[model samples]
Target chain A: AQRVTQPEKLLSVFKGAPVELKCNYSYSGSPELFWYVQYSRQRLQLLLRHISRESIKGFTADLNKGETSFHLKKPFAQEEDSAMYYCALSLTGGGNKLTFGTGTQLKVEL
Target chain B: DVKVTQSSRYLVKRTGEKVFLECVQDMDHENMFWYRQDPGLGLRLIYFSYDVKMKEKGDIPEGYSVSREKKERFSLILESASTNQTSMYLCASSSPIRPARGGYTFGSGTRLTVV
Candidate 1:
């Protein structure tokens, strides 16, 4: 069974502090991982994908196949960055159907 | 811009009542999905449609049915709404471009409460 796991239910950091949201998966094949964020009262949106190897909103996630991880990281946390973040994986041979992990709620405090 | 729209932001229905939740996408996406979100469970797929009139069962398709009569619309129906069915229903659509990099465009989500 393929599963995605977000170990942290809540992560808190002071403003300007570095933040890391952990994500791990259990799959038998190559993985395609993504980070999605949902702001208060806003629609869920993609933050970054490992395949892109690019940062969005100063956030980056690297897919570590050896460890089966794709942790999201940011150098400096901002108040506006506080939101519920989810890690998702598409099935290997499916029509883009996603399997999401229980999200991690990140709070950037002052 | 990819635009996905849900029919309602909030809804209330009585137990055993028939319910319908509609979603539409303007981006001509080839794939559309319905998911129910809970506090700690994140999002669980209910059903998905790859094209008009084509439907597939997702991870959690029990107690839910879906329809896709046209290219832009997908509907989720509950034959008999139950309290456990109360959740945030999210609709997502995405094109098949760059399968690895393609991220889904989600709607604002519908908060349904079954009494």
Candidate 2:
């Protein structure tokens, strides 16, 4: 079975500090990973995907197949970056279903 | 921009009552999904529809049924609402082709409370 695990339930960091949200996945086939974000009173939205290899809002994630992990990272955390982050995995076959992690609440404090 | 809309932002109902949560998408997507979000448990898929009148059970489909009479609308029905059923329901839509290439579009989510 495919599964996504985000170890931290809550993470606090001061503004301008580096932030890293850990994510680990379990799957048998080639993995497709993604990072989703939900801000206060905002709908959940896609932040980045491993395949795109593009940074969004100064955040980037690299798929580490050897470690079976895809950690989201940002060089400098901003106050506006406080939100809930979820890691997801796309099923390998033709279906569009996704398995999501429990999510991590990131709080950037002043 | 692709848009997925849920009918309500918040709702409260009594136990054993029948509940209906409606979702509509203007993007004409082929895939629509229903999920319930809970603290610590994350978001668990309740059900999904691939086409008109076609539905599939997701990870957590118990106590729930679905209807998709039209391609643009997907409805989740709780046969008998229970206190444990209270949750934030989210509706999402995505294209079947190359779903990995493009991420899903989500709604504002309906926060349902069963008292």
Please, what is the TM-score per model? 0.97, 0.97
Clashing pairs in 1: none
Tens digit of per-residue lDDT, candidate 2, span A15-105: 9999999999998788789999999999999999898899999999999999999999999999999999999998667378878999999
Report the C-alpha lDDT of model 1 over B12-86, residue by residue, as the tens digit: 999999999999999889899999999989999999988999999988998999999999999999999999999
Could you tell me the lDDT of residue B24 within candidate 1? 93
lDDT of 1 by residue, A1-110 (tens): 78999989999999999999999999988767899999998999988888789989999989999899999999999999999999999766655778899999999999
Q: After superposition, how far is residue B88 of candidate 1 from its true place, in Å?
A: 0.5
True contacts kept of each: 0.74, 0.62
On residues B8-112, what C-alpha lDDT tens digit does candidate 2 reach at each position? 999999999999999999988999999999999898999998899999999999999999999999999999999999999999998887633338899999999
